[model samples]
Target: MLSQPLSKVLGKKTADELIRQGLLTVGDLLHLLPRRYDTWGELTELAQLVEGEHATVQAQVLRSTSRRTRGGRPAALMEATVTDGASTMDIVLFGGAGLMSHYAKQLAPGTTVLLSGKVGLRRGRRQLASPRFQVLDDLSEDEREALLARPLPIYPGTDALPSWKLAIAMRTVVDQLGDEDVPEPLPAEVRAAHRLVDALTAWRWIHCPQDEEQWRAARRRLRYEEAFVLQAALARRRVEHESTHAAVAWSLPGPQSLRADLDAALPFRLTAGQVRVGEEIATALDSTVPMQRLLQGDVGSGKTLVALRAMLQVVGAGGQAALLAPTEVLAAQHRASLEHLLGPLARGGMLDGAVRATRVHLLTGSTPAPRRREVLAALAGGEPSILVGTHALLNESVQLPFLGLVVVDEQHRFGVAQRDALRERGGVTDPQALPGSQERRTPHLLVMTATPIPRTIAMTVFGDLDTAVLDETPGGRSPVATHLVPWEREPWVEGIWRRAAREVATGGRVYVVCPRIDVTDEELTDLAHGSLGVGADEPDTAGLEDLVSALGEDPSPARPLAAVTEWAERLAAEPALEGVGVGTLTGRMSPAEKTAAMEDFASGRTPVLVATTVVEVGVDVPGATMMVILDADRFGLSQLHQLRGRVGRGDRPSLCVAVAGCEVGSPAYHRLKAFAETLDGFALAEADLELRSEGNVLGAAQSGRRSDLDLLRVTRDARVIEQARGEVQAVIARDPGLEHHPDLAAAITERLDEESQAYLERA
Candidate 1:
């Protein structure tokens, strides 16, 4: 299907060789684009070199050759220099081996050219190392000089295809088409209002702009296209999910009576925000549409109270509620705390009197196979008024009878697809005519998170969900003081501990956290040696199993701080962690195991349990008052904030010490240090977006997924993303589907096709 048509055109590789890299479609060929184009327009005057700073010099080859100096690495060194006549500079080219055929070696030099490269001193002789060089052609020196005055366009490259070659190919492709088939995606009025241009024109100007205006117009169009496509896809996915999921009819008995019952039973009064959110949830229940709301707050901001109140409304409506947490630890914690709050619920209603009205049951992986099966059976039989679990609740075999509401805690921890998956199974939207059809009705949802996200980011990530933020932490709770120590600062950390000892003397407890469990056997040995007193070997969440087993076996009065990082194995090993009552809690633990661990930690039976950064988001442990972060430099500021949040949860005072060392000046160190200073979520969020990219919005370094447009920084692109969201919604409202609009469909298809391909590859 492919042939060397280009060989006659450029005398380079024929079409046959190109096909080997999956280059078959015309679209693929165009996307080959360019890495960068050269402008021989401006030649740098060599006299301006500062001797120390690396500089970019653009000159032509006056002369060149290949040679390796006495002790230097091998190279094709081209010595070429250009002059402004007033000042002449020396230029030596190194590592030009890869450019042998690019006339770096073929000329007697004097070939007027553009040489853009990093200028450094080689043996005090100024040299340019492996920078881009282009043989000046077609234009006079003045014209070339004019071209060099502007920024250049760069594109993608592959192992075999050099960037320059890619640029040349792109120039060839654009030559044939010549920006003739540009498509306008927006309507005329919308385009006029937004100052948008056509995509093809943008692509052309991005490669070979007529001027700055053309270049900027092109960029705006392309960036908007990117933002529009992603927003539209997200919108489409959300709409599809919302339409497909089941919705429970919320016919709660009476909020006035429910409030009275809660007031009589609840130990503390609801905050203003909590009361307002309850009204919203109550209002949502009365509507035909399913409630999809996010309840956000920092640690101990009373999100659980709001959620429980909403659940009580669900039960009052004669329907069940389901709560799903990322980890069983969080799930069990939710169940226990919820049960406590709900204990004083109304008696004549579902949560009270005769038959244990609204029955509550926990369904987790560790619920014991037989018992687990029974829990599934109970849920099927509608035995539980509220069902709580990890992912097990999403199991196809697990059925929810009249599940009216769904609460997902820490929603950011889940992928959009996974959350939609749960909503699809448990939540259904019934048809217009039928109210309850056993087929379609989405459960009202209240998504809860303690991460304290900035409002801007929340809008960007959860544009579809209603948001309720609780900024005020409960009164009387002490703010934990944070400290950053370079691993070598043992004395300083000890001083903090000396202070903490006094706090401990008053019946307070301490929690030491780590980044990971032992990922290696060496880490295990180090743990055994207890060498982490100064700087922890980056905490591995893996060795948690071994550490738990070891802690249970080696119970000693010497180990005062129960490490929370090693809990995976602690529960897997024995029923009790420290004879003093220690246990582990984590994402991997089944709901039952987490329930047990949380109980142990909360009750002060297991004063310390080893765990991962999962504790970065608060899981109520009132008794714990002290926290030690091992390998403190390994955590981000946001994470450090969350980890410190675990403490200072109760009426007791709390303290946090970041034990540093290993990998000083690491990103984690910078993050933790910042965490030590700020209690503001918005500030940390801005810093996070600045210091991180999409891959690290949560964690993991992203290599492949970053988009090509650098102008669309999420930090700066907020306005554009918001505009796109609004425009897409308006357009969809007007057109329903873009079936009649070929241009919009093409743009959307390109995005979905790419996203689908990515999903397939990941799968």
Candidate 2:
């Protein structure tokens, strides 16, 4: 019954509306818990009501009047004075003559009613204009008393079906539900330990609570169930991985190995944090059990260097290593950085170098056919080398022989399927097997993200992976000074360019980041013609109604978002940068074009580069000392921090000016302010989670699907999550197959859909 389609229970029309909101099955409707509850006896205080705020008040009508409008086309209007026990307010109703007469009859003097609307001030009196009203005088004394005693549920509803209508639909389905319909998923022992109610009782109380305590208890049970099922799934995945998977044990390099050679050739000393994390990774790689690890570090913290050392160890152990980046630009940058670090050693067999040297190859979508063939030949020959590329490396044509280590940079940018596809290619010969016997070995996986993930988030999203953090930066890298500039203030905006000029004058470079590539001509034409129509020809407005309902209509005219193309032109013409060369870079540019632009900026031929967030990660230019972010309010705190990291890489002092286009005191402005005040990526990550809510932490944020999490908030319910994880680990340890706890096993299957299971499996 719980698995039955909503249409089978409710009518087709109502089911379609519910489906539009992503609720499909009977169980889905049962879980659409009320966001809040309203009590008839606890009326809103009219005297405390603020103008321009929505309110719901229960009051008695003192008097009522209906009159015709004075306009040539006559309309009817009804006016009444109503009073809660302590305060009086006026209510206005406007409609056709017939509707006004109907309203007047329903709102007669001495009538008690419930009204909800936005409060407005009319002629020194508080009034509810065009309010929705429910007459209570028609109800019997017992019915009125019952309403006053019970809490009314208010669901997350739509304009077409408000809270009351949804309540009726829920009542219809829940009335037919029984113990068999909602089976208990938690083990009896666990339930008794946690003092949680049975699943059926909890479901009923959650949707139709008689009082506050019943609802609270029901919510607790459901929240725990959500966490338990998810954690159980993760624990099961861990068990499967440990039992079934094996990886090539790439032991520590010898004193004369490439890893040691590179360490001796390094220009700077590694931070203590880096050394610690490197040792942790080295230990994992030396194990035969497949390594699943997450490396999280702040920007410019030398994550790439640590990853390269691990890669070198694998290569020195007679196994090839692969580094997967999210973009071609970053992939190219990695190859270049590796070559520069390796010097003549990168040439390997092609040039005179150390005996332990190995070649570094680049494979992206745009790689020339001949060069691609050469790279493939080297990999097919089973040579110990490093391969760095984007998603192109995931193609079936590309093979990694004796692949040992897989390093994913900016792991959040790629989906689990992409990462797993490359890891599955690691096939090596088993030493203990007979000669020529090959076995499929899972490569040691290390995923690195510069965007620091909050603690709870890391535990929930990456629970299957062991984590290491590089919290310190190498010495001599100056900390970036951040400032927020109001976009509306002309002088403050001018000061940004002047500051950029000053940096350039000192032989430093500047990066101007914008929110968009460019405003197209078609967009301008649409704006000019006000062509935001809802016809089939205007498909862009398909969801306009839903958006308007969610956000409401803003009275202020919309402003154009800053664009790199336009800003680049405007900045070049600015007097402060009149003589400084300016170049533009965007994702739309060809590979050659992007390389040329970056080369120009790096060489000081173009000391200033205007770009989008394409340079947000792993694009290093040490000479760039200033970053100016236009419409910075459009970016999240983590992204703003990443953009700021592009500068301050050199020894010179650096500055980042965020030109906020949002009004002061708004949520966006507050986010910008929080970002400007801290250089700690972890702190900003927590703030970002709080401000934005943990957005689809279970793969949806990357896959563009709805999150599996419904009731569990990673941040607020950290303790509950921790408890669930501990209990789940113990349960799985005793019963790896969960045969003794069939209900709980079923719950795991139900909670993790195909995609989510794939995500957790890859982890």
Candidate 3:
């Protein structure tokens, strides 16, 4: 019973209170895994140490000096000298004596201390500052040497608390748990079949592993747990709610309804792709099993028309439909386009009179209560026929009278829960429920996105779903002629702007884009909120303070990048492009404001729109054929591709200029270059994933898109993810109840941690 709380680790009792939330248990502690492991073991003589070598040296502190800032503790500056058998080396410790009070107070001026760090030559002087130090106690030389060997785990930590300290603290607690957390839920026979370890052993080995041998044991256990719960939960709920759910195979008003709608809506001819996809959708909507289809296309590839046509079938069958988009802008775009494309269908009564009107109701967060209530009523009464909205449609208050189909736009942005929310609107309780009005009816789904999926990935990722790719763009829209300019040759922007200004003067618009609105580490209190989403990331104010304090006596370095308004100001003030009214738009801007800014650019009111990626998704300005991307290398290929799509909308020939600054090179350069060379978005998406760094893939989990993982370079393990998913599905199909397969259930239970579930197939 030597169990002390995490208070010892965090230096505060408050964090220990987190144990009450189940985060302090040894099983949970083990799951707070290390991001990396760094070893500073190669003990070498200072004279023998080469530049860039991470060398460890035993040195004696020769002298110490101290200084105080305005009100903070005075940092002690230490200068130490170390020697081997033949030569001596000078080691400078910038602020160790005073800053690290605990360490300094423990070691005397002339004491023998061991330093571990990389050797660097600064201005011809060998330096070893801010090196981690260990005081030699009564421990034997071999014991200390063993502790310094190989790599030590680096836990995820905050600035107030370092990872090394966290690991040490965790190790102490884990020692008490001995071999496991809860007992293994799987049968012994199943463990042997899958060649897996019991749950307790897996977690125990994961956190306090003696070697890499335990990595798979821990990982598989966690992965299984995550997948199993998600699947089982979905299944359990689906079956429970099946009674009220109506699984309607066909909602069409027979051949007469389609013929009448098509006959009345024949203003524009459907492209072959659109026609084919429409038929496929109709067939899916009329099917027995719940339909899950993805309609993929490049920008302006005529996707909205296909979606609208599918929704029309629900209308034809006496049922209502809803279209959900990720953002207000996108939702609005879809609403506008949906109205125009299905105009003939919505007017309902007349076939040959005035302009055809589609009774497509719009629902978003900003919608007035009166209007939303009206829209909701209309939807229940099947008056609007179809509804278009953002996540507001998923609200519990939004009732569906007879919802037959639900279309999710930018489908990848949503997760299983969000999609399931809309699917459950018609009343299918969960996945196990058969089609029809039982517990809850289920609606057919048509997921659409502007990004085309690679055929192979699409097949595996959406194995159970049908798919259609809109590969061609409409005829009149010209392909943008793209050019790539290296960082040093960024002056190409001048040439592009001069030419762009000339074009705008003759009635065109220009879009100037940067990778980020502001890189300044400080967030403006006014502009820190996310426009469309409910929440945002909090600033690490404490961490920032600690970093500044760690700097000893220098002013805090500014974070790079300018915010939207600031960027707009700088672009407008450019002496070379004076008087070019520059408007700004970003996630920081209000939806109404962003819409207004975009409208200005579209109407040629603002000739130059200096923006971030906000304009990359929606906001079509056909007049904006001239796009100048500053610091293109900083953007991912998929993003660049999306930006490139902003133009080339009109009949006019469009131009895109991607400019890179000299300082940034390497992989980024190649990525931008690849995007500039091809207009193919799918190719760019793959390249973007491949070239992306660690932060891009794993950081957005808080946004509810945790399932979006990248195994680009880890293509070797892709088969494993697919195998797991398929195996899970097959297991469920064979044994809908876990009563028959204890081993599979056990494996899944072990792997279902928050992080594992988030990454899942994508990781």
Looking at candidate 2, the ten consecutive residues that score lowest on lDDT are 528-537
TM-score of each: 0.78, 0.81, 0.64
Model 1 misses residue 28 by how many Å? 4.8
Backbone clash total for model 2 is: 0
C-alpha RMSD by candidate, in order: 7.7, 6.8, 8.9
Clashes of each: 48, 0, 51
Off by over 4 Å in 2: 4-25, 43-149, 158-160, 254-256, 343-347, 431-438, 452-462, 516-565, 588-593, 665-667, 697-700, 703-705
Better of 2 and 3 by TM-score: 2
The pairs that clash in candidate 2 are none
- Taking the tens digit of each residue's C-alpha lDDT, what string does model 2 give over 652-691? 9999989876766776767787898899887887776666
TM-score of 2: 0.81
Q: lDDT by residue for model 3 over 273-365, one digit each (tens)? A: 887777888887776566767787887888877877777676665566788876677777777776565555556556642342347777887
In terms of lDDT, model 1 sits at 0.58
Candidate maximizing TM-score: 2
